[model samples]
Target: MHSFSIILLPLLSLLPSTISQTSGTFNAMTFNVAGLPAILNDNGVPGDKTANTARIGQLFTQYNISLIQVQEDFNYHATLYANDKHPYRTATSGGVPFGSGLNTLSNYEFTDFARVKWNTCSNIDSADCLTPKGFTFMRVKFAEGVSIDAYNLHADAGTTAADTTARASNLRQVSDYITAHSINNSVLVFGDSNSRYTRTGDIPSIFSTANGMKDAWLELVRGGVAPQAGTDALLCDNPSPNTTCETVDKMWYRGSSAVELQAQKFQYAGNMFLQENGDVLSDHDPVLVDFAWTKV
Candidate 1:
């Protein structure tokens, strides 16, 4: 089990609130749990891949995560992957051959859920187009009749140029849709973005642009003098460990609510199989964040 702690500081200029009352603070996590399709046959370790499903469930239960976003999935097959104790509703996109998919799980009763497919390319050089993938958007009602949007996204990955195009286009489609039909101003986007801020690309652009939205991690680092998660919570450091780096997985938020980010973390313990004698859990580590929403 991995543990994370966060220290919050007051913002000099507080942003305006959009909700009447925050009601309560909640935690959200994004993890690409290496799709546990029914057909996968684990070579060994911890009673094969099938046996590890329970451990996955236990992790979720331990975190008390209100919302979860994951990538790489097979609709019917993946449904059986989760334990019965934490039943959830999921939405899948993308096409066969390419495993790009999205999965969202929420503990709260979801008022509405749907998948929004954008666009993608199978190969940047090749003319073949790939299918886009995304997850369900839960309309969470806050105080003052305000609402927040929760979602997930998995963009096509590859070289900088290729990945950039796919991330931007797909993000634009989703952002446009949300801005059009969202019940409230607040929106939380999370999942495998596949592009980083230092890297030249659109994944960060689509979210950080003046159009609306801000990366939750970047927001946390704002005006903070302490060593925070943003500087240390690099999820995929196992493949090539270097003074803690950043990668695709990310979280974003929208709306004019003075949000005081309480905590943000990366969970990489028993799951950091590379360092744990190959007890491989998933390719990407989970990112979690806690926030306090102020109501207008």
Candidate 2:
């Protein structure tokens, strides 16, 4: 009996630690809150920024969503998700203004935040032949040296070849930023991208080629291989009844190696910044994903 006990104890000791090195979960939301007054007026959506903002606060309370990456306008939308107890830290790309486009929010204190402007169309150049920087990247510090990145973006509608090209350029640039920096073990990029999967360009290319980055929606929802979907269960409006509008708002994660990604389901919470009326607060819908990190 003693010999059997000795062998069992050794096997148990060999098992990996169940306690996460940096345990605890974080919820992230990406909403395209189109300006303020427009959202409030029934002319836009049933729930204006004010009402939706209140809803957002309530959501934050209910879900305990800490990391929020909001597109459209960071400065203006920041007001919608503010509370004394649940204050948020923010970062925006310069010159974006109240409605200039692109912004991110976070419940964690920002250790450092920087803007990586993508190439964009210019007023000086021919409208069809210009490229502009796209989106803003922010890094937030959590307890115990753990940190993650949130990118807020609104890519140009890929209605034209020029717009598509610009978006591709911006997506690549964001990847460059990630590749250049030494991000901690965990990372996430979320926002409203006017483009869909297999559309060709930035995100698709990155997910296909970038070793570390992978699409959350595709992995968790489409693939059904992860747990994060529980927090992002809401579906975007399918304008075309015959077609399933694959998600445009999404989240991506960095794998253990620049060549391999380790993604799993956390939870899926759909459209956090939504109004009661059918009308959408913004032209696009918001998506939320929660992640649990364990240091290896």
Candidate 3:
């Protein structure tokens, strides 16, 4: 019922391709569901969170998203869970005011599921302290003997000094955890990282500088070039399908000694999540990244 099961995937996918022992593919996504209670919902964001969340969950199966990380998955989580068919999903950590608002859904099996709270908090430009904001981690298996450490997080949001300090600590916490627990293991980190490389005072480089992970959007979409110095300049106000645009929703990945991983595509998924009235489902559009793996 609440997130513990052993659903088997296709036998063919479970085994590496015999023709090319290394060739395999999978896709991962991160979306902020904006599942705040009606009273907390941003008036600017149309449609009902409860209604949209169900559809959001349904879309994953429709798209065959291999794995998903959802942030702001607070209130209305049941509806999201009810509609999503993914056999591997994280149990909600209660709703906002009590939860960290982070969760993951996967088609493949995973283990070592864990949650970690940020060591610091602030409510300068945003109300980060109103809930137990933090990150979640797990080891997802792509196939037999093939597993990668995966993570989901919602960091402190704001631009004030207090906000930057807290966000810095948040990234450091994730980086530290990867260094300690996932060293030499393949890693796939995704979620709403509020911090932006273009924004001043953001430690967005910690993923690469500390964990040796590469940003999918930066490397595959931007040709490995960072955004020009600016204040998160490309934050889209509406659902945008352009993957080159800068955003807080991010994905970082790295391969291990036995398997090599490369980003095949980075997509900003939008059209599939729109409501009848053409309004987007959530405040943040999902980041979907396709990956190809081969034995090293």
RMSD of each: 11.3, 9.1, 7.0
Residue 107 Cα positional deviation in candidate 1, in Å, after optimal superposition: 1.9
lDDT of 3 by residue, 1-296 (tens): 33323344555465666444455899999998888787965636777777788888788777879999999888889999899899899889999799988999899999999999999989988889999998998999887667889999899998899999999999999999999999799999899999787898887778998888899988987888888656556776557757667888899999989878899998888766887788898878788899998777
Which pairs in model 3 have colliding backbones?
none
Residue range 176-230, candidate 1, lDDT tens digits: 7776766346788888776666554444656556446666656564432212322
lDDT over C-alpha atoms for residue 89 of model 3: 90
Candidate 2 — which residues are off by over 4 angstroms? 1-21, 36-58, 81-85, 91-100, 122-133, 183-185, 200-203, 224-245, 255-272, 276-279
Measured against the true structure, the TM-scores of the candidates, in listed sequence, are 0.69, 0.69, 0.91
lDDT of each: 0.57, 0.54, 0.86
- Of candidates 3 and 1, the better by lDDT: 3
Candidate 2 structure, TM-score to reference: 0.69
Give the number of the best model, judged by TM-score: 3
Q: Cα deviation of 253 in candidate 2 (Å)?
A: 0.5
Per-structure clash totals for the candidates: 4, 28, 0
Best lDDT goes to which candidate? Answer: 3
